[model samples]
Target: MMIHKIFPSRKHALHSWNFVMFRFAMLSLLFMMIAAGCSQVERRDDQYSISQEPQRIVPVEMPPSSDIDIAPSESTLSPKKEPETEFGIRLTRADRYSVNSILEKVLEYGITHVQLGGELITTVDDLILNPEKKAFVEAISRRNQSMGIHTYIWSSELNLEGRTFHFNWTAPLVVARQSAYRSVLQAVPEIDGVVLNFENAFLKPWEAVIPAGLPPFSSRERIRFVIDMVRSVVVDEMGKRLLVYAGTGKEEYATWLTEILENYPEEKITVITHASLQGNEFLDVWHPHFRTVGLHRHLLECDLTASAFGGMRFFNCLTDDLYEIWSQSRLHDVKGMIGLVEGEDFSRLATPLQMNLFSLAKMVFQPDIPPDMIWNESIQRVFGLFPASNEGQSLQALLRNSFFWWRRAGMVKGIPLLSYRGDLPEHADLIQPLKLIDSDALHPGIRFLLDELENPRKQTLIDLAQETLETTTWFNRAIRELEHIASSLNPSDYEWLKQRFEQQRLLANVYYYIKQCYWGFRYWEKNKSEEEALILEAHLQRLQQIGEHLEQQINSTDEIFYAKRIRDFVADIRGHFPRVILGWRDRQWNYLSDIRIKQAGPESVELSWTSEQPSISRVFATTGFPIFEITKSAVETPTLEHRVILDGLKRGARYIFKVQCSTEDGKVTNSGEYLFQTMPAPLL
Candidate 1:
């Protein structure tokens, strides 16, 4: 090679040609080698011929016309379905009320669930090993019953040592409390869960004064400790899921508590809220699994007091707050718990007053009534207590004075009954069936008040009271008529009418819609700044699209069937819309991912998504598809994942999906989708 190079360097023509030839030879060798490799691959491929086996096309056999039963061939007769009447009472342990008697009364009223009072479990020892109490609990359970243990350990009077007003957030004490509570629960197999009186224990400590010596724990820390305690009891000791109910007053505390519970399984923990404190903020925190308590005493006393005063001022009070809370809870599809403070005398005016109050409380926590109608009906019911007679002037004066004080307290309006502007015709209509009476029938002192109003000196009070009474009467009549119509119609017809009523009612109150939107905006603005506003705007646009599509479908339907269909649709829409909207918002906000839609069957469709954090799913129906089924499955992966499946979809239909997600930090996200269609019918 050296000699050859030297020859080339010498600029010999033969040497240059030889060098070129050598390069060409090497290139040819490379190409040949590559070609050989390619040939071997081709040969291997040729040897491995995948046989395209003849496909056995099995012809689908359509049933013969005689055998092809489009409709169920057995009979067109409908099943003899039993009418369902659900009734439950809030069973509490008051000094005057016997637990056994109350239990019997509950059976009489067909009440199913009871919230056992903390007083019932007077001491830790009582909670753990009281034989009589244990026997009672066993009896209750044996009768296919459920009991929510009032409390494990709570302070009525917070002191420095035992039963302190303030909680000790130190790890040792917290852990000890958890262990102690767990031991109690384990010892008593009948106790369902613990109801921690957070509000009574913390915010409104029973101690008359706060002690200066001890350092107070931050609210967040307290909430965390409580949550940790619950986890220790339920997850560690019980070896099964248990409920930790923080009976809270403030929405902020609920938010904090929920944040801590985000680490626990949704099925394992639940938040129980008093009816009167429900609001959008609270709803945002608890969502689907929030449990509401309808306490009878608050409903009658506080709510009635506010309504009698006519300012709707009571709206801020716990009693008045429950109406809206119940309505909103139902609207949000949250589970509701009704507590009837029964065995108290309703025959006494005070008795009725108490009864009404508690009834109102229970009503507010129900996942039933429309929200718009909630306050109006509640107010009307309260005002129904006034009498028609001019006698008992003193009583009337007392009532008016009480009403006046309520108004001054910012619990109600000072306007005369008729002068107040809050009554809705539809709400009034709904109330008629409950047989609500006018002030004359309701208030023993009303006659005297009426007389005083008609009297020359009492004209002012009379004029206002009369107007309010008249308006209430009219409202009551209208509601009665609606009820009559509801009763007379066929089941399908009644459903349709209900839907129509809801639609008209909601539409009529555009202000409420605007208010809700504004609230949503405010929430976003506070939490997400300008970015949230943009996201919300996008959501509104999506909602508009869905609304338009729904409108078109609704409008095109037949008029005769419209009322029933529309009513059912509206009810379903109300039930399902929030969930879908919230869910979609969550997805868009990066709270979760992997949204999947699965077709379970002809009658069912399931929408599922994944979140690394703990979350909840709520399903709603908008139209003909009236039912849904939710299921969760575990998937085996390097990192274990959960797959949630929703089934029971209607074929040839469109649906909307709403989802909401929250994290342990109290960060909430929502998402929604509209006009999702089920898969087409399978080809025969």
Candidate 2:
């Protein structure tokens, strides 16, 4: 069947006015599909599947411009100086600025374009459904255009409300999606283009769209079909640029993207990829996709919010890092970069009006300028210039080394504990597993932090402990160093800079204590030494102090909800404390957590644990060795909280065991290997 029905046929008839508009939109899409060379002809797969193989839409020609240019305002301020590269800023949380503040910063930083995300209008669905939001966004778009700055609407594909067009891409869903895209363009006709990042999605449609999966050629073509379907309205009909996110770091993705771009004219489809491989957690080296062939001609997305490193709400300055990103982008295709400025939703990150937003502008213009120099200039702009002294250098070092220190501390053994979403506070289920940082693994979907940490040749627990402590200790020390110089500076500048540095210090310590707390448990599991347990206790106590501090600060939220999320974050971490503390001396935990050796008798060894939620526990044990062999006993646990005793075990025998917990849905996580010894028989 073809796309005869967009929504299930309504028993009630559409209003006469809405019916006319719907008719017009369908007609426009039909015209675009035919013009864009989307073949409606049936394929051989029609006989095999319930639905027909959807005909692919591929753009063959550029159509005329749809939007009329608003005459530039006579008072529009030309940038005092614009950089050669066209720099853009994508505002996730746009409420941070008014129309003039946005334009003033745009002119100040020589920004050419602004990509507006959910902060203003929320989503493309809002534009189609909410008249009030559409009016507000439309007014803003016009205001931006009047100032001679381009504006692009951010669209998350298949992610609109009531339309999660995920893996299943039948003809009806595809056509409905295209119709929705057309409606957005038709409604907000003033915007330059749409920034769609489904390509950057965790489960990218190219790989997941088809269930049994299509061949390479078919997969690429299928994505092209979706692209061209949107382009038919956004580009071919409207003469607008389509900025697609090229986020997959795979060379194959690059190859697919290169082929896709080759099919379209230059500048028709702008491919933006993150400059950081690990999505701006810290220690962000240039992404491989950023250096790829066709992508060089596109833009690099640089995140200034520093979501994982405490965002802009806390001490957030990436002045030096921005220089590196700008340098890499300059070396690549030189289309410039986009900074993700401002707080989004209930995220922990906030884009304070200050915090060196202009440093990015400074670095790109003078790429060779020292990071310290760029930061010093930005600091001078905010507060009066530092006197000829070490005070300036100390301040510079503090900002420059902040990111470096945070990365070393936060990412222990080079693995990040990521939230399900992009470091949003509301999505704080963070005591989860670790993810492989920046590896372009052949396959997608949850790659393990455990798998990487378990590498035999990787850094030992002791080495990680040392490095994490050193980086964090120095960072905290640097925060303290600012006090000595506070007397030399004006009180307000001192307070402002100190607050930023203090936030960094607190976050660094948080990462440090959490890392030590977790790693200490794992380390103690190996030898179960008294000294290690004492150290672990100390780390946990510090975590408790930090959590208390965070609670106090969040209590003073000052009406900024972003500041309040620290409560959720710290609470979540605190929630994990007692569970991980299960093995410490004697603690009864009724939750799912790390496997612990509860009791060992002369003839029996006991293994105990809890789960993330209610779960069934299973234990596999091997005797007198670290490896589990074919003859190893497999014990099944009946409930979420469990203590399984392996009876009739030889006395003084060392048992190697792994406990895995399965949720009701059958999702399982096998925690660390534990060592246990049965009591010696009669002290022989």
Candidate 3:
């Protein structure tokens, strides 16, 4: 008999709780939370006396108890079969009834590993406090192991004491890791190994973890040191494997990997990474890991969930981009893939995007088959459209255009700037920070476009507007073409796709308007005139209209395809109306941001600041007050970040400087004087 593990959903929670008595529920929950004892469970320990069973939603279609048996013993377990390319799926949800069905269906696609994903259990403390989860995982793990399937858990941190406790990095001793529970491995011993995410958005940097004085470890040293620590518990003592998820950002991941490989030549630990250089967006660039000596330790993953962009609640598709990763994988000596079915917040379990989920899984077994054929087969089965028919081809075009437009929608001038994950902005606050989160500056390319917008040195307004408009236009075109030919397709799928695509297609307008508004604001800000203000407000009003439409859809379907996030994104745009466009118009202005002194020397000082809008800025300084004498301009180039060098200064002298910034459309503002002191003369 096979066991089933399911994620609890909102719909099932109501009935599942009805069966549990209040007293028993509280007692059982306490037992699970204490399964990882506060002081007892340590490195390499697998002691489990926990029988804290929460009320699991029993599968409706599950076979009767009389027909099932316990897991197969080790002696009777099936032999492992090694395929050319091994595959795995990362699952966060386990619905009561259909999870068994979902598992049974995916296993047929040749997955050798089942990663009970990171989102299923987050921090070390989270797992420590939730033993029911570990119990559920262990139950599934035993059955998976009997059939030669490997199980792994991706954990964000190793702090066992909880989110409050920080590791004693001040002491470079192994004793510092004392009292820390290897919670996941200790709680669920049946798992093959554990994964550690060392960087990316979730990391607690040295600034946060370390008190004061101690600087954060370098990327290379941090990874190697942490790997050694984890290896002791996972690999050395427990005799299991260790996988270090070095994180997904392109430069950060490459930097860490480069440092680790260069310093430690024979690192035996496996690294799990993704091919999408940006968040959930796949491009044709070469994967950084493939550039290294040993590709076998690198496991390439692609997010089939599209969690960062949005859930498949909309017509979000990764079919082509995912296939591109498969094509790249064949070129490398890579380890098996681990497909993450859920990310951060969103999932694609029961959605229409399950076709993408199954198709990517089959890639391990049928690497030679094209993604198109698999997609077409899924379309035929679900929509009842024959692969050779005109409606089927039109559907294909719709999917392609849908993905392309979505890809462009999240970007501003080619950088992944705007993102939505379900009902929320992927990042916390989208409108307030003109700069990227945690980043002191925007991408240089985005700055370049800001330059063109403010200065109009290159790419006219018409050209700039065309960037997002083309994508919006073609996506709309594809949707219209499909609607005309899809009369023979299944009504339910048509309704589902219509809801998803209409919202997404509707958002393509928001994308267009976002760029158009940027253009409109720049045109207006150059003059701050009545003519320009009306044009700018009109653009803003267009955005407000779309936001209302999104609210209507969300209200009608109770967020059928999850337009709430996009709605919030449009609201963010409306919010900018007051803070950005209106504020700019109604203020006495100096448009500098992120202003700082780069280098202070006896002979010269290098200063830099980013203008709110692109501009050529000149710095005027004097040893005296009020009157400005000497002047040095930022480089002839105009950009958001501008710089000037105040040279010909005496040692130990104090200089007061002010800036005058000039936009290309002929507007200028004089800044208040700011002061900086030159370094004292060095002794001879």
Candidate with the greatest TM-score versus the true structure: 3
TM-score of each: 0.33, 0.61, 0.64
Residue pairs whose backbone atoms clash in candidate 3: 6-94, 7-94, 7-95
Query: Which window of ten consecutive residues has the lowest lDDT sum in model 3?
Result: 43-52
Q: Tell me the whole-model lDDT of each prediction, alpha carbons only.
A: 0.36, 0.53, 0.55
lDDT of 3 by residue, 133-218 (tens): 55556666776676667777666543321122224433322222311324455555667776766542233332234435665555
Pairs in steric clash, model 2: 592-610, 592-611, 593-610, 593-611
Off by over 4 Å in 1: 1-90, 94-97, 108-110, 122-175, 202-218, 239-241, 246-248, 261-264, 277-325, 340-684
- Candidates, ranked, lDDT: 3, 2, 1
- Per residue, candidate 2 scores C-alpha lDDT tens digits across 1-684 of 011211121122223555444544553355346335565523231111111222122211211122322343432222123235767887654342243355455666777888887445334644544444465566666766777677788775544212123333444446555665665665566677788766423234455434344433355665676677677667776667677766534556656766666656664576777766244321132244344444435776766777655564455567656765665566566666777765333221123334445777766666666665666665565545472468766766666556655554455444445211222235343334333344464123223434444442113444444445555556667768889778866786678667766655555555555555555565565666676666666666666666566555664342234334444544554464433453443211222443456555668767776554676766777762234551322335446566677777777455656665555765555544344555655722
Worst 10 residues of 2 by lDDT: 45-54
What's the count of clashing pairs in each model shown?
62, 4, 3
Give the per-residue Cα lDDT of candidate 2 at 453: 46
Global CA lDDT of candidate 1, please? 0.36
Which residue segments of model 2 deviate by more than 4 Å? 1-84, 94-100, 121-123, 159-179, 199-204, 207-217, 248-255, 277-296, 343-356, 366-372, 418-461, 545-554, 557-684
